[model samples]
Target chain A: MIATETALALQAPQLMTTPPLLTMTGVSRRYGDVVALQDVSAMVYPGEVLGIVGESGSGKSTLLRMMNLEDTPDTGDYRLALPDLPGNLFDLDRFARRMLCATRIGIVYQNPHVGLLMQHTSSGNVAERLLIAGERSFAALRGRAREALDASEFPLERMDARPIELSGGMQQRVQLAKAIALEPVLLLLDEPTTGLDVSVQALVLDTLKRLQRDRAITMVIVSHDLGVIRTMADRVMVMRRGRVVEQGLADQIFQDPQHDYTQQLVHAKL
Target chain B: MTLASLTKPWEAMSYGFLDASAKRELRRKMLKAIAVPGCQMPYASREVPMARGWGTGGLQVTLTLLKPSSVVKVIDQGADDSVNAASIRSFLSKVSGATETWDTTEATILQSRHRIPEERLRADQVLVLQVPNPEPLRPVEPNMSVARQMHADADYGRLWLILYEQIVRSGRVMQGAAYPSLVNGRHVMTPSPIPRWDVPKLHMAQHLTFLSAGREKRLYAVPPFTRVEPLVFSDVPYQVEDHAALTCHRSGVSGYFMNEIPQDDGSSAFEVSDSHLGIKTIRQAEGAAIRIGPTWYENGKMPQ
Candidate 1:
């Protein structure tokens, strides 16, 4: 597990000592004529869960997907300075680009259903990444996968259990285990806890927190739930119409009134 | 049904494209592999422009199995890059003009090396594993007759012995990759060299998982709904590894397996354990453009 706080503190002279793992500058994305994000700029700093919040059509998902490599921007540049590495992510080729995406970054969709293939078992979901990474040695795959399952607090019996057999929370835990097992540097969570019940959400959040502190992974969580953000995020980026309306520390965003849109968002939640 | 009827001619002799004989052999072996889950067979490996050991198994399957319109993904060590992966991708684009993708969901045929894709492979996806060695009995006994006999009788007695020893000494499974498993709770098989982390992902996968060993003469499969159990002991139980520190600075993911590339400073640089191509999806995300600030960086080199 990477120690998120420590990784957040590492100083790279080339990066100008920015804590950000990914920095977007004047980023704009258009799908033919549809502008998804316009001049959106933000830095996803280390140990900080930048909560991209907004209602539907706010471009929150689009913005999050952009950081994932599934979607490419039409204009502007995205620099991903790996926490400890010298080179940025953009320096890779199409093949190299995809390899990094699967192993280095972990993404959780708003719908847990989207994140996992329902046909596979809980263990299968957790172990998929390991297999893809070319650890074809069966002993190695099973041992590490089982370890991840234990770390995620999943039941041993569920290793062979299919996704459909598990509860929503259990499936989420399996997804978390899958992501964690890969040891990704960035975690892109699209409404990670949205569909989950309160108790299950708490469990999942707690697991993420433990994993984060242990691993030191940088996180960019996109959710409308402020509470989830408050609990996990160090900083927040509030998205409105594919633009950042407000950005600051989590505590400050909750207490201080910087932007009316942010204030209203906080108020409505409260 | 006749050979002449099935042996069709090609208008364009595309490189890396399997001829009729190769395709039939591959298809026949694939069916055999599927019938006998977790078995490995040697297919006629093609000389792709890419070097060997990248994704020969995947590329072979792709060339033989692909339709004209099939959308394929060639991932080496789980990522789509790496010299071998890129070459395979290039080869497919030339011969079949098939669409290639890094995303697991979009791919119809996925040729993967050690690691599986991070995303869940669906029923629509057919995963072809590149096997260095296909024989599950290779590690145990050298005699083909004995190994085949053992397999026929579902004899995994040696597996238990191996697990028991681990318990006695390490008190845990110290193994990392290429873990062996029982397909359908009967046939002892290898899940290829993919990390243990990916082993569980194969448990009843929606897609058909095919294993092809080019160097070795073997092919195998784990049919949908077929049980693939990792070899483990009941007393010590099975343990999976977690990134005590799960984080990738570039991708901002915690709780994923990472490869530690040790720098000169003695500090380890964290890369995703899977090949780098898998991370391309994240790097190419909508907001990712904000990171580089208008520089088009491709394949680790800046366009001049």
Candidate 2:
């Protein structure tokens, strides 16, 4: 077997005591008048879900996008080591870089409705990445997309329906279908369950957890909702003013925040 | 009249080929293509005096689907002014009552034969192709029923054998005509007669593809983000036949896909070509080359 293909075969989630799926060291991103993220260093470990919690303008989204290479940092380095892939994201030019994102790293945006292709049917959205990955047989695409939708605990009949026709929760499920279809190594959720009701959010979160368990998908979820962070994250980082104010194991951060800002933010949630 | 005059006609509607009802039927098929993602559907046929070979499939789709507010761009064999291309452009303008432009970046709908626009089409735009044959298996097996059954079963053994044959014959897959493609992972459809060089543009293309075959009366859509791959072996690999031997006539673009123009010397010659944008992009590429960032890689880096 070729070294690359063998490397892919050998790749397994070394989650229990692995280094990290992603690492941002001294990363800084600056716009003309505002600094989005400043010297922000963090590690998204394998197997565990890491939550970056902060308020509206707290740079959580910026940090998440930076990890996805959606927004490249103005200074410092960001490294993403996908299993069996040569080089990091920055090594590829524009075309190959995008192909990498479609193949390895999948991002689900906050607005469930907008993230999916509205015009395409639920099945279309779910099977998009597989097609991009060059799975060209219709039967294969349909069977795989159907299986994915089934695995998500979403209805099979609704697969033919458009996003607009489906409920908010189903839309999130479709988004999940798209993200998980490729079985990406690093899954980035930018508040995926934001618009759903509490019950629906629970279902969505449960589905995500199940998927993460089934595939050793390392996830980094960005959100301001403490409840979501507490439920999903194994490790938590609280940010304020473009910096990590407090970070620790979720239980530890929830019980005892080191920074005053973290305390104030947590207390306000209470 | 030859198809060359179908350029930039304003407020012209095709005399009577696509009546209101026929257009509506075509529109419905287009919507189904978008809805089903990769499924091919039948479309109402429109008669174009220019005949089938010269982009009538592309022109018909453009005419039936074009909105009055749309800006249409047309290209043939990747050149804007190729006789066949000019013909389609004029036909679209005269029939659809839409405006036509040579600027691919500005066009809302692009009618193309044998080439994707050199520029990446926008998400809002639609790309219509004139398909000689839509089925990738048509060449291997003449029977559509057998081919459809093979597609239905996802049976690509025959297609794989053909690719393997190419590898056996040549060191690489040297077959470059209307390259076979896997669309949305459900169908292995042809991107009409576009060269294999233009095949990569169809993969994860931001714009949608509305392909029609006037002869077969079929229409299909490859939605944006739908995966489109040309069948190739991992070792041999599929490759685009870029113009390593020629340069753009207007802007001196070297090694892009080119169209042959016969010279006074009685030998076939090539000029820089992009069907969607015409020769104008050659000039733009020339100007941009001077300011190109060092990080911007060119066609030379394409894997051989």
Candidate 3:
């Protein structure tokens, strides 16, 4: 038994060295005359957290939106490497994009209120994702919702409470629970902890870290706060004026930023 | 814009009283509303001849779905002869060139306020219910934005609490009308002021139901065979009003909802609430050979 356990543990790190799960090349999105994102290229590996940092209107949201398939890029190639199907998601039609959004991608908005359906019970909110994924049995839906909420450490008794009744922190946690309920291959978060209190921010970050590690889920997190990026990101990308300025390992980017904008960002955060 | 681009050769009126663009928009919204049963889909509420609060929502939906061959029945609190019901019915037929009906059995489309017809709706029929208030959480959370957020979160704990409080205070569920019900086990929709007896008819029913609120600019649907469970604890089952055993004085019809009339001598006389049903029963009794259809409630009891 000791030999088998040792072998399994040795194989785990080898799995981390696998090929990238998603890769984008020269992705550009424009709204009429204004460019939202231009020539933004990046890669995300399996079970890794990629943090994107930029000021407001830096096109960080536009890049994330493209990655989420909520908006299509005007020009670029986005290849998502799945186990069975590794194809360009941008090439798919609107209905296909919607299907992918339901089955493969899960997103949590910056505003918890936007992420959640305030009228539904917490379990109902989670159950909706499952229902969209074609789960029909009530028992199965409820069971999965309960499991996800439990994993997120949400109060089991208040699972039926609406978002309006819960605190801002609890609403964010419910959003997390709802997003992870589907067990998607990719999870996207936009300004997840911006409006949260300091103590509640720490708790939410802690919960997110645990979920990422335990589930081995790949993630793309967009935030302006460097502290959030430093704590949670495996890699970091800096953006300015709708363009990628610099990209590197989290420690390298924090310590030795190449671009002046990135250096100024690092200094400002300090 | 040029006159040619802005205007067309005018006719007497648009078919179904609504313009083509209005009908198209409603059609799109109705499809989405049907797709996600019980989730309120927002739409642009168009102008109709009737006042805003007076069944305009139902009228808009009925107009959108109306055809020349369609037979429509409008009911106000189970009575077809009421002023509101009669006017709406006449207006619908006059505009669409369709037939107006008082028989639930013959109606291709049934529009109602505060009631569902006693007769069981069939698979082919569509029922449009006028909703004064679309939000079920309005009582608990007054803020519309917060209520919307709660709806998005699927949080309905306060609703259950309200019911629990009602039971504790009144010894029974005192909510007499518009009991909040969970639709398709997901959304807690206000079944549009429907009596408790009528709410159960929506659960796993053969026909489709659309509940629209014009003032609120929202609409929802309960498609055929969807589950519509009334909010209730396991220990306390839902109880409809006790009107099953009372017999109607004029038509001698028993085992249905009734309206009570008080006598000057301090006595009470009951009449069938569904006026058309009462008329049909009376006619059948007088040997006119009218066919009374199968009802949702059988022999004063709704089957479990």
Candidate 4:
């Protein structure tokens, strides 16, 4: 068994007693005439990676955006059942939503250019998020940024260099560092390894898995690649168009997919 | 719309010489500049009565922050009596109804050209330095977009190469005024043509500083307690101009920066570069009770 499984096994009784970290019911969104998501209901338990896989126009990005609060759904009931938070997260005011987005939620975009500030130093990009979250001391900010970059396996010397100087793979690592610097409760990643080389993708995936295992962070990873889902996810949700086609354990989804679209996807991969 | 609704009041001039919307925009940009020390924040450089290059950038900033109770000070190359300085100072007071002072200690806002005040400014003061050229990479890369990309990439290798070439040709760095310095250890900025001697005064200064360029439409800040280090190689130490030994001929003050006056015969007479400091020294010598505040340089050397 993997380290995450071993850790989960150790905390099995406590995990059973705790509530799901996040719950969404009947979430629907539309942009003009086109529907992005339709009547999607999902629950993400604590300390687990929930992978969403779909084709190009399959509402997966839209779903991740709704979760990150970048885009609001037309109708939904979203609840964050953490111990410290009270009431439904979807009912938060504009200011409260901003606060939660800034402090509690971290997101990694598919394009590193979108995720990281191109003009800012790697350390500066990481420190920007911490500064928004009210970390004032320059020493403390730099310290935490350095720690995060180290965890992401970025070179310590290049922390002062800007994003333009870094390669595509390095920029992605910097983005990961910036996202996780706050040690947020929830992480949302959309097509993180899509544009990266195979070797670089492997390295990024390894660093991400190590970080997730170390922090036990609840995550929603959206990807079109079934291989990525199989490697990273404990539970897989297969999406097509604007609906969930199949949802189950990673092994079951890979070995015995019941839905036609999922079976086609598995066969194509094989 | 009715004529009465079109015009509210027959006021002579707007408060602080800028419209309310302009002030609001500048205020927002100023906050962003302070939040990211040394990062240049772009803004709409508003129109003023003065020409674009003649302290218009500083004028806009002063106008944005101006109030009736503010004490404004304007100086050109350390002299308050210069035509540019006097005109800007009068214009500021006339527009905002604020008090004008030559004393650095009494001023709440000090807008200057080419030189910082000789006296140490308090924490309450805001220094606005007029900049002709804001980009330090202009010497290395002529294209603005490429320069911006270089800035984004933190690729300053060419800037160091320029300095290295200067050292190779002249046996020392040839940069005189507006020496490029690294702000907050991230962004390199040209400190607005202030002499090398004046550059050290900005390091970890108590007062907030804004460097604005009107034509460039860019403004950056150096917040209080931020680092401003001159770029220099360890092998060759950074050196200020050798004006420490020169004595001011009129004020009889030694160790301060001085302006060299060529005499008819073949001799040079030195006068204090900061005219206000010289005036105060002359007053004190004439037995007038003049209170001179603490200076950045004490007896020709900055305090360690």
Off by over 4 Å in 4: A1-17, B1-49, B56-74, B81-83, B86-273, B286-304
Residue lDDT tens for model 4, B196-228: 999999999999999999889989999998999
Q: Mind giving the per-residue lDDT tens digits that candidate 3 earns over B1-304?
A: 8898888777888999999999999899999999989999899999998899999999999999999999999999999989999999999999998899999999999999999998899999999999999999897688999898778767676676556545444567889899999999899999999888788899999999999999899999999999999987655788888999999999999999888999999999999888888999999999997999999999889986
Model 1 lDDT tens row, B122-223: 777798888887776665467888787667655555555444334434656776777888888778777888877777778877779888776665678888
TM-score of chain A of 3: 0.92
* Candidate 2 i-RMS: 13.4
- Candidate scoring better on TM-score of 1 and 2: 2
Worst 10 residues of 3 chain B by lDDT: B161-170
* lDDT tens per residue, model 2, B209-303: 88888888888888998898887655454666756656656556665677788889898766655643334554456575322212111553332
lDDT (Cα, tens digit) per residue for candidate 4, span A1-270: 123322321233233566778787778899999998988877788888989999998899999888888777888878787566676677776656766876888889998877876765778778767765656444566688899999989999998788899987899889888888988888889998998889999999998899899999898999998889999998888887888777877898899988888899999998
The 10-residue segment of model 3 chain A with minimum total lDDT is A1-10
Q: After superposition, how far is residue B121 of candidate 3 from its true place, in Å?
A: 9.2
The CAPRI classification for model 2 reads as incorrect
Q: Which ten residues in a row have the lowest lDDT in candidate 4 chain B?
A: B160-169
TM-score of candidate 3 to 2 decimals: 0.64
Model 2 residue A28 CA deviation in Å = 1.0
Find the 10 residues in a row with the least total lDDT in model 4 chain A.
Answer: A1-10
Residue pairs in clash, model 4: none
Cα TM-score of candidate 2: 0.49
Comparing only chain B with the true structure, the TM-scores of all models are 0.82, 0.82, 0.96, 0.96
TM-score list, all predictions: 0.47, 0.49, 0.64, 0.62
- Please write out the lDDT profile of model 2 over residues A79-153, one tens digit for every residue: 676655545455555556556777778788888654676755677677666766766555566678888888778
Please give the distance, in angstroms, between residue B22's alpha carbon in candidate 1 and its true position after superposition. 2.0
